[model samples]
Target: MGSGRRNLKNAAVALLSPIPSIIFYLSLLNHCQRISSTASDGDHSLSLSPLWAWCYYHPLLLANVLFFVNVNVLFWVISHIQSSHWMIDLYWTVIPVMLVHYYATHPLAQYNWWRSKIAISLTWVWGVRLSHNYFRREKWQWGAREDWRFTDMRLQYGKHWWWVSFFAVYVSQQVFLIGVCLPLYVIHSVDEPLNIWDFVAIIACLCGIVVAFSADTQLHDFVSRNQKLKELGKPFVANLDEGLWRYSRHPNYFGEQLWWWGLVIFAWNLGQGWTFIGSFINTMCLAYVTKLVEEWMLKQDYRAEAYRLYQKTTSVWIPWFKSSIGGKDKKA
Candidate 1:
């Protein structure tokens, strides 16, 4: 989950506000130029919904706009029902499935079908793992818990949070998604056959997923063990600078950035090198987003000195840097 920061939310909105329109505009322009309302005979055999009849002229743009709209509306409704900020968190992982389905059923599906499937497959694997992690953290329950930052913002904004959240939290996040996933919107529809870039992209994407899965699993187990230890009236673990944590303070964040870069790679060779802005936007988000999360976390631990020492030794984002702050004796 993003763990919204009160100060950052407004800034994030300012920084990311332009992307959604750009994506929608580009999507509309791209599809309007090439796509048509009528598909060839074979596409008619697919058991697509009647909605496709309306989307005939601009299937990708239609899917793109519909998805972006549906998600924010759904999140708004869920937030009212549960008053939880993370109501939209799981959507981050799961929405790609629907995206893949939409593109796969498109007339362009007949173009680079297999390569697109590979991209979708990698997305599915990462999505499933990430969704499971969120659920395992018990975030799926409506009203069970609300992220602290949302609570803070609610107090800070008073009644304004009702409207502000609709834009800053929900809409802004969708803009980020639409921008970063633009390649997915662009790639499958093209009729190019598989190329070397596709293979390289698949491997890099899988590797990123593996890194993320491994890092998140490690953190989950560490937290779980510490919870049990606390329940048993024992001391909690001092530092988490173990495993991938040894290399990067936030390995999962790094891995996700890598994963999106891999997706960018998929479209890079198809005259889509310019698509990296999406990945760049996400990387910029991670740069301070993790710091916001850590601020909240540090409050929970109340171990400023230990965490500071840990921070000094460990690289903040990248891994395998030339520093060993690892004494293991000092508590983080």
Candidate 2:
């Protein structure tokens, strides 16, 4: 009976997981394309000049499509060889740099290199910090290195996990990544002088960077210190609900979400209102990650009760909502 139930669960997950979700999103993308197709191509071209002229000749679409396909192929191949789930993450840090660099490379936009520099430099900083954190945690391992959340899904879903990983974990994120990064393409296209949007982006970006960087550092330190205690015959602590964590259950996720949205402000200033989709999709992705992480925590040996209590009191996503403290249980 247990085996039969497992098979059923796996089968259900296979049919209903991220692929269908992404397909629905693709339909949305199609709708967006239809709506946007009515706009004149004259608008897509840089107003600056014809120097970086080729990007207007369908290069952006080609580059995006080709790069998107290549990354998914890498993810699909690497999924089978290494369960590490690192491939998706590696690109998170690496690709934004490429994207901004892509923006900066436009010869027509050379007059506005300052704006591109600001965006690209900020992105590079974020990428470096995040990738370094992952590296320090030794998550780059090749074999038997899947994220705990992914492993939980594998166990619950039974035998079809590889396919699920490809669809849900990998392929689904491609468009979202590019979409959330839409700001990168546009921020470099415009030649506007510094304005309120620039100030907003700068301030928000710094706040986000500090919050995320600090939160990760705190968590890392907490984990490291606890590991040392365990090695010295102390009990392993279950939660690190102090500092920024006291205010939010997922301060790290919160900060990162703000980080991308902050970057979107520049795109909005460029009259690329539709580019808001990029940041929104990424916010949804982060929320999903937060949910899965909490679920995974609940499944741990000594974590169920502690995290249940933590969940009762802590804000799930927002950074500092006082009302969330010691609040009633809210289901994920």
Candidate 3:
């Protein structure tokens, strides 16, 4: 009975976690609408307020402000309550979808309607796939576990994790989430007609989604098989070097990068090439993350030698044919 009740509570928490954020966004949207109406009616009282004016005129800035309050502040408190920071990981699949719609619904939003729809629809597809993967990895249990990286950091920081996490987990996410979604802002800010680049972007984004889905599926299946083997007292597989893993050490990361870079094409085609900065920064961060992940895998006794060989032959990313080099460890 206790376990069942706890499961129910967790399910509710997962379902309702976004309600406060949605409410805050809607409230802000309504306020922006009011400001727009009042300003048009020559009521300078509200428009004269710089904060309101910025919210009305700058949707990108408004999103950042909302992130500060909703994620940085609200999520931070919730993490303390739950004694976990995994909620941010879940929201990573959510916030882009919200930000895209926020840009579309804002009164100041101006763009080709068809283009906006395309971008918004793609964002939804990406978010849904990612959310599905997150839930699957969690065994459909919300907040069951925090990320291993966060667990490591907690151990590393000891008592200081409480405050260190405020900056490390939440603030860093503010930068990453907002940065990656900059293309959404670009898509909504321009009024350009669809062109060849739009079609190119569509292809690239779809390809990314497919590749990521395949890689993650393969990885999940591999892990599940290993678990079963362990349970049966059989020797579990030490490494995965088949399917997408054969071509790239991290095909999933490559696919995710492809998706973001693909989105950048849309903005670039619309003459907002600077929007690439977001995707570029994301890629750099991913590189560092990839290093950390590799280091972790190498630390595992069973995986160390096999992964070293895999690393020697497979590309770090960008899915290419395996190298001709043998599995012998390179001398320092």
Backbone clash pairs for candidate 3 read none
Candidate 1 lDDT over residue span 1-332, tens digit each: 44445334533432343345446445544553343444455454243344444565566677656755656765576567656666566567766665765666555444477787787788789889887877777634322455666678889899899889888677777667777787787677676888898888888888888889899999989988998998999998766878998888899998888888988888886777888998888788778688787786677555666677777777787786535444444424
Worst 10 residues of 2 by lDDT: 44-53
Q: Which model scores highest in lDDT? A: 3
Worst 10 residues of 1 by lDDT: 6-15
Per-model TM-score versus the true fold? 0.79, 0.75, 0.92
Q: Candidate 1 has what TM-score?
A: 0.79
Instruction: Show the lowest summed lDDT stretch of 10 residues, model 3.
Output: 323-332
Kindly indicate the candidate among 1 and 2 with the higher TM-score.
Answer: 1
lDDT of 2 by residue, 1-332 (tens): 76566445533432333243235334433544554466476453433234323433443564465455556665566556644564565557776776676556533334256787788889989899887876667533322144666767788877887778777776777777778788888887677887888889878887888888889989999899898998999887788888898788888888888888888888888778788888888788778788778877888868788788788777887876434443553322
lDDT-sorted candidate list, best first: 3, 1, 2
Q: What are the per-model numbers of colliding residue pairs?
A: 0, 3, 0
